[model samples]
Target: MSNINDKIRQIAKETEPELIHIRRELHQYPELGIDLPKTHEIISRELHKIPGLKIREHAAGGYGLIAELKGKKEHGKNVLLRADIDALPLEEKMESTYKSRHDGRMHACGHDGHATWLIGAAKILAQLTDEFGGCIRFAFQPGEEVGLGADTMIEEDKVLEDPKMDMAFAAHGWPSVESGKIGIVRRYAFGCVGDFKVRIIGKKGHASWPEQTIDPIAAANEIYQHIPAILTRTISGTEPKIMSVTYMQAGDVNVRNIIPQDCVFGGTMRAVKREVLEKMKTELEKEIKGICQVYGTSYQADIRIHGGSVKNAPELLNGVKKSVADVLGKENVYIIEEDNLGGENFAEYSCRVPAVYMFIGIKPEEKEAIPGLHSPEYQFDDTVLAGAAAAFANIAIHGCMGELKEN
Candidate 1:
């Protein structure tokens, strides 16, 4: 075990230059959503440089690459390490040499860093094939930002079809924690995401004639006012849940003298448990309809199940906690007791096998960390790359070694 850790550290040190270049290249050319053609091309080219990698591309949606490193002993477990390869639709705000060249799009979530780490791991694993057994699959996924990439990868049967993946692991770059630290939340890591679009229909009339019109704006206001109460009553305090109205569109702006005939509202709901989320949805719908009925108006709500909550496997998490502590030190690792409402595509892999989702610290030392992920100012410290790569390699080797019993 000591020898493996030392080797991982050495490999990370040796690959630092390449990793930097890969991240910068990815940073300069950012692609949005599932259509990552240029990004896929770069990944394909790099992985092909390795000796024994089997790669495949998805016919629809985006590209998914599978690189297999065959083992010598054949007694070890088959494991997988995945990294998402999509960028967000936000203009780059930093003044760095590797800023995004694409307009209105950037790799704000540190996915470029994630992809670089996985590639670095693959290179190391390929070089040290004699020490490990079974196979390690590298999944370069697409569309994580829009919340459909993992499902697309799964529907294509990319990971499940591979006989080598007995378990899987992945990580995300976290901006709140300082560089060289790691955060591991074992129980409930992230919340399920649900999107709702509501439409209210009412009769239009002159503003002066209040009795002649059933005002949709008034009904929407009522529905909005009742949301806080609904959340408080329907969702328990022990469970983490939040509902917010993000977008609203009403009648044309030019006609202030006339009441609008209809109004549209859209928002999201997040929770740690699926059943609880469903209950909240039902209650919200019923309440909205009832309120509309009272106001003599009709309403429609469209709720879409976007992403499921991230539930880390207990055993995998234990392994991760130990591995991260081993590399980053025990004091730097924090185990969060509660679930976060943020959605991650990594949850899709958790459904198939034992998986661990972790956050690698990228907070700057001087200024307060950039705003949370997806914000315009969000940026990760490149120095965290060494710790992140080492931690990921440690988790991969430990997971494939099958030393820890399932919890």
Candidate 2:
């Protein structure tokens, strides 16, 4: 086990140049959502260079790529290592040489680093295929920002097919943690995310005549005021949950004397448990409908429930904890009891197999604090790339070969 870890660390160091170039190239040319043509092209081109691998593209319009490294030993369980490839729709605010070339598009979530780590894992795994005895599938999925890419790839049977994945694992770059440190929580660390769009219908009339018509703006305000109460009442004490109203649109611009007939509201809810989430949804809908009825208005809620809480299987979580301790040392890994409210599409992989979603610390040294992800100013310390690559490679090798038992 020590020998394999040493070999992985050495291989990661040797592949440093390639990893840097891959990260820079991806950062410079950022694509958004499920339409990552250029991103897919670059990933496919690089993976095709590896020997004895079968590559397939399954994302809608060539946005996702899957590469399978066949095992030397026959009939072994399959495992998957995934990385998201899509960028955010934000203008690059940094002054780095590899800044986004595309206007209003950037890899603000550290996905470039994620892709680079997976690629590093692929290269190291290709070299150690003889030592590893099971199949490893590299999934470069798109549209993780909007939370639909993984679903699309799964529907297309990209990651879990034929040989079927026995387990899956992925990592995100954590700007909050210092470089050289890694954080692994036993799944369900992050909460589920669900988006909703509400439309309220009412009668428009002159503002001067207050009693002449039902006002949707008033109804929207009421709904917004009612959300906090809903959250406090419906969400149980067993799990953490949050509901927020983020967007509201109504009425005509620059029109002072008119009451708008329609109002639109959009928001999201986060919950740690599935049952709590279901309860929240049911209660929210009923409350909104009742409120609208009281105001003599018609209300329709178009709720699109997406990414669910990431629940790591116990076995996989233990294996990852061991792997992190082996690569980054024991003190660097910490178990977080409280679940993060942010949602990650990595949860989608849990549906197929026991999966682990971990974080690699990339906080910069000079800055007082690292910027939060999805912010235009967010950046990762490149020095963490080596550790990340080593961690991922070790997990892949040990996971596929089931070497943790030997340790």
Candidate 3:
């Protein structure tokens, strides 16, 4: 391993106590969406303690904070490190000293850990600026759940400007991999995401006369049944795509006897590429249109595109992977074979610059079932904090100083 990475690992270990304190505090008082007032305050307070960090508050026109640290040497390449600080709408289900105090907010997606390790990396890199020759911008953003935080930071706050970020990077906590390890994706790691709502319109009538009503429930049931085949039967077999109807309903529970005037159903669609996702969405509406026509009902389709996939720079993978392997042993760095359908706002950064997003494992070796992201029971492994911090710092060190060298 490189000597610079060794020092980063050491500093990260020494900074664990502070990392845990900040993580716990942020986890306890979780806030949601772009307007994270308390989250902003806690992150800003800890970042201000680090020397050489020029803190930029309200980077997203909300509570987003970006901390920039420059090297003592001549300017080289500019790198951006990002962490989403928003929480989910779920209530914390796990018991701990740092469980969320807020009733309806939770850090179920592990952004608290992301923020902590980023801060820890800042503290570590601040000490070793003499080894590198560029500026590192630590972007602590909000509203990742709504998929607007990264856009606001880039377009509104000009996060990619000022220094003109040459490369960007971030990591996600994934339970699919073992704890104390890391996972690197060679290509696209996340798929394009789109949400949709379909409202089946019909006429209401008494239960005694089935022919008198348009029967929206019947049309809705048919639409629900056709959802899975919308992508499988329509899109090409070569293209990886999926459509899942997460929710559907119609009529009041109090009056079950009368037929409802209309029924509504909604779900999400994903594809390996953005064009494929759009095709799936269009096919879905076409399928719904045909199904509703057969049932003698009109329908409304409301589809909202979230964002694009996370595309890792093909040329930069080996270099960043080597940097991560330097911090954590090479044996601990695993390659992810498949891309996930989950959405991420970080694609906003990947679209404009050379970017790579890795995954830090949080799966426990014990017998209990592992919780997935966005679940109320999801727990982030604190043991990965030091390694994650070291990995982030090492990426910056090697990327700016040793970028041209072969791994």
Candidate 4:
């Protein structure tokens, strides 16, 4: 490894205590959505200690923070390193020292670690500004769970403008990948996220008198059953997609004798690309319309695709892989071929710029299987922070200096 890479690894490891402390503090007081006041304060307090960083506070409505670290040399290119600071609306079930104190709010998605890694990278990169070139934008985003933070920052605040980022990189915690390893996906890393709702409207009447009213429940059930069939038939079997009906509802349970005026069902839709989402939505709407027509009920359907797939720039993959290899090892790094339907908001940046989205492993040895990301029991050991920090810092430094190869 090069001297700078060695230095980065050493410093990142040495700062493990600091990283854990910050992560714990943030984890204890987890916040949700865009308005994260306490989360902002904690992050800002630590970032203020760094000298070269010029912090852009609350670029979005809430704590959509961006800290710019301009290098001393004018020889290289502008690069961006991003992280998220939002937590999910789930009560943490883990009985750890750093368990979330807030009710119904927790960093179950490992975003606390994500934020810590970026903060660690910022600290390390700030110390080595003379060793690099161009500028590094450390975007600490909020509302990543809602898939709106990056979009708002990029579109409204222009976080990537001014110097105009040449390359961008972001990483997420992957419990299935095991600590000390890194996973990379070429082209599309994950799929686009979309939410759809279907409402079946009908006249209300007593349940005993079926002929007196049009039943919306029957129409909703028919539409729900046809949804999965539509997906299976619309997209090819080779590139599978996901459509989960998270919720379905009708009249009050207290009054079972009365037929409800309306019934509603909604769920998430995911695909490797927007084309798949569009195809599924088109079929779903058609199915709903036909089913409602048959049941003599009117229907309303709303389907919106939130963002594009998290795509990696082919030009930057080699550079990123090399950076990870330097921090961990070539053996510890991998190029993942499969595409996941999981929604990641980092797509907001990658879809617009040359960005690489990575998944850092945190699977513990004690457990037979890793806890899912949004699970209440989700947690990662503190060991993975240093490696992630080292890799991120190295990527930012070398990438800015043009030491990293570009296709």
Please name the candidate that would achieve the greatest TM-score relative to the true structure. 3
lDDT of 3: 0.87
Candidate 4 lDDT by residue in tens digits, 1-407: 48887789888978999999999999998888898999899999989988889998877777878999988886878888999989989988879877888999999988889999999999898888889778899999999887668888988889889989888899999978878899998767889888898889999999999999999999998888887688777778776588889999999989989999999999999888898888888888889888888999998889888878987888888888988898788998999988877888888788777888899999876666878899998886688998899999988887887767574
Per-residue error for 88 in candidate 4, Å, reads 1.9
TM-score of each: 0.95, 0.93, 0.96, 0.95
- Model 1, span 1-407: residue lDDT tens: 87777888888888888888998899888898778888888888898887777766652265666667776766788888889888899998888998899999998888888888888888777777777777777888887887767776677656755573777878888887777888877677778888899999999899999799999988898898898877788678777788899988887888788988889998988888888889878888988888899889998789876657778888766667887777667887878776678888778878777777887788877867477798777776778777787887777777677854465
Cα lDDT tens digits for candidate 2, 1-407: 78877788888889888888889999999998888878887888888887887888755446788888977865466789999988998987989988999999999999989998888888887887777777898889888887777877777655687777878888899877778888776547578888788999999999999799999988889988988777776575666788888899998799989999999998888887767778888888887898899999998898766757887676767677788778778887777655677898778888668788887888765666877899999886777787787887778777777754323
In candidate 4 the C-alpha lDDT for residue 300 amounts to: 86
As for candidate 4, its clashing pairs are none
Residue 11, model 1, lDDT: 83
Residue range with the least summed lDDT across 10 consecutive positions in model 3? 398-407
What's model 1's overall lDDT? 0.80
Name the TM-score of candidate 1. Answer: 0.95
lDDT of each: 0.80, 0.82, 0.87, 0.87
Q: Which residues of candidate 1, in runs, are more than 4 Å off?
A: 58-61
After superposition, which runs of candidate 4 have C-alpha atoms over 4 Å from their true positions?
none
Q: lDDT tens string, model 3, 191-306? A: 78998998999999998898999999898898778876776687788777788889888899999789989999898888879999888878777888898889899988998778
Clashes of each: 0, 2, 0, 0
Model 1 pairs whose backbones collide: none
